[model samples]
Target: MKYEKALLLVLAVTMTIITELDLLPQIHRMGFYCGDPKLSHDYIGDTVTARYLLLISFFIPFLILIDKNLYQSSFSTYLLMYITFIIGYCLCISSVNFFKILFGEPRPHFFDTCKPVEALKCTPGSYVSTFTCTNSDLRRARDSTKSFPSGHSALSTFSAGFVLLYISNKASDWKRIVQVLCIAWILSCTVTRIFDHRHHWWDVLSGIVYGMGLAVITLR
Candidate 1:
């Protein structure tokens, strides 16, 4: 348990820095430089949605730990609460960062800092911006390469799908409805990433797919 908390905290901070400093620049060279037009930055504003969602999501695993029924009743449920969550979150986050570095998809917020021309291309090593950063010496503003799949989208759906699986097995219809609504909330949380100008539709889509895939794999 102690190791888990330590590992989770380290990973969380690492992901935050990676998204901020390394990914932002790549996003700047793409089109529109913002999220989809429908949600816009108006009703679906970026800062408000992102801050709340990202912050609140940190507690999900903690809450799972508090729920006695989640693990004590079944072996599979215990695995879902512990092993799957650790592996799923680790894999999804690491994969997103790895692919972002490999794929280099520009973020929607790139327009805020730089001008993105038509069909812009960033040379692999030579970026429009040059910077040096190591793991220990991470700069939040230096996240210039992290816009492949949405981590928040992945995390939310991952937990939601876990809850969905548990709820589906329960005998209560009202509880089932509540679980369904929770799923919708998770989906809306994914949508909020686009509204926040942090990810594109495709990024969110990939995240949703990753999360659902984990849900199914972990369940079976």
Candidate 2:
């Protein structure tokens, strides 16, 4: 195995162990302060909203970079980056959703919208009828149900991080500056999630760590 692959395996295994042991809570507290995260899902209807446009604009160039480097670039490292991103995409989505179903932690507007708590178990009836938020929030409880790890944070992190790695290897001058800026961008994305109150700090942190860990391990 490549030495990097060996390091990747160790990192993944260590992460699994750490999370299972619930060590993060002891390490990091909540956040700056508990802010109300409830945002109107209404803006989603307006595709031109700042949130929508900002996110799309940020990701588009990153996608271009990934494409440029992925199958098109000559570097063998790029191939590994490509394969790992495809796999990480699946894993991130699946793992977040799976945990959401398992936990069913209330959404941000849970108090305002949720029906009186049921047995807190995922029964067929609960799935169909139990709790709901107003608006499309009610329409997609499944998406809101699992807030432990922020998927948006994970995705953005992965994209930025992979590109950062590519740039780190490819750039000639100001490599350190590029990487620092990328890490700052990652922090900004994670903070945005908390600022919007879409997720708790813990959730974003998980995504940050998961995104970086996977990128470093899987792509290196």
Candidate 3:
């Protein structure tokens, strides 16, 4: 078990490094125009940071108390479980980033990021890939092309789904209500990406699928 735990920890760390290095894949410009910049502009959601903080806060107590109680209070057991969780979380996030860069689907606010001239009009259902973005912020411009899979949805669902799975397994009574609330929260977060114009509906859907799939696999 210790060796398994160490392997998982190493795998998680490797995935984290890969994600941080941005070494997975590059975005391919599709030049797809989904909508006007005015329609795509909206208040950006801060759920990414909020979800990370929530997971850390909740998981620390959960591991120290609930998990400990459930598993003989052994530190090694707790470490193993925690490492497994980290592996799952990192894998889900890194996979999402991989797909996001691989697909290179344009965000709803592509026009704002690209700042292409209106004169180079794209007919409905057609794309104009020949234009360059006028946005000075290179990071933002690059991010605009990585909208295939919503990172917000992916991370939110992964974290929330993992918590839900833990509660389902470890909680005594009232687990059903907690599970329902978790599902609701996950759905709400997924929908917010659409309202924020950071991702399309399909992107959010794919993210949910990927995240939940990873959670289930990890817990199993």
Candidate 4:
């Protein structure tokens, strides 16, 4: 069993790395324009690194405390469960990244990144071509095309949903409160992506479904 888990972890990590590498250039492709430049500009939300750190900090203690109170499980058991959660998260993220690259849908703030010169002459709702980004940040320009699915929403939901599933399985008086909080957090994260002009409603909806689906499969 240990060997099997180790092999699974290795495979998940390998696939995630390959997906990340493929994302670089794949995200640079042209995507469907869906928003006006004037209204779409918004500050980028929390960084991915920060979000992951926050979720880890929340989960580690929460899981450990739950295990101690409910099952009196050994440290090694808790550790194994934690590692399993991490692997599940990696798989979920890898799958989402693959879809983002495959779809190549433009973000809400795509115009801010693309800065098409020809767009000046084009009427509102009309497509513009033969343009370049006003900003020299190629990375941001590339990311502008990876907006079909909201990564933030998917990741946030995965983390929250995982915890919710664990709580539901455990006998605890705080389960209801935790469940409500988890659902609220997931909704807020998904909504904020739209407010930040990072994704469309449909993108967020798709992400929610994807994340929840994977969480159910992984947790079970």
Candidate 1 TM-score, true structure as reference = 0.58
Worst 10 residues of 4 by lDDT: 63-72
User: Residue 101 error for model 4, in Å?
Assistant: 1.3
Give the Å error, residue 48, model 1.
6.2
**Cα lDDT tens digits for candidate 1, 143-166:** 333566777777678767766665
| Clashing pairs for predicted structure model 4, backbone only | none
RMSD of 2: 10.4
For all predicted structures, in order, the TM-scores are: 0.58, 0.54, 0.77, 0.79
| Cα deviation of 25, candidate 2, in Å | 28
Each candidate structure's count of clashing pairs:
18, 1, 1, 0
**If the candidates were sorted by their TM-score against the true structure, best first, what order would they fall in?**
4, 3, 1, 2
Deviation (Å) of 206 in candidate 1:
1.1
lDDT of 4 by residue, 113-197 (tens): 7565555566667654334656587777667777868877787788788777766666776666667767777877787777777
Which one is best on lDDT?
Answer: 4
Model 4 quality (TM-score): 0.79
Please tell me which model should have the higher lDDT, number 1 or number 4. 4
- Tally clashing residue pairs in candidate 2: 1
Model 1: how far residue 144 lies from native, Å: 4.6
Report the error of model 4 at residue 169, Å: 3.0
- Tell me how far candidate 4 lies from the true structure as C-alpha RMSD in angstroms: 3.4
Better of 1 and 2 by lDDT: 1
Model 3 residue runs over 4 Å out of place are 21-27, 34-75, 117-125, 169-181
lDDT of each: 0.55, 0.50, 0.67, 0.69
CA RMSD, predictions in order: 7.7, 10.4, 3.6, 3.4
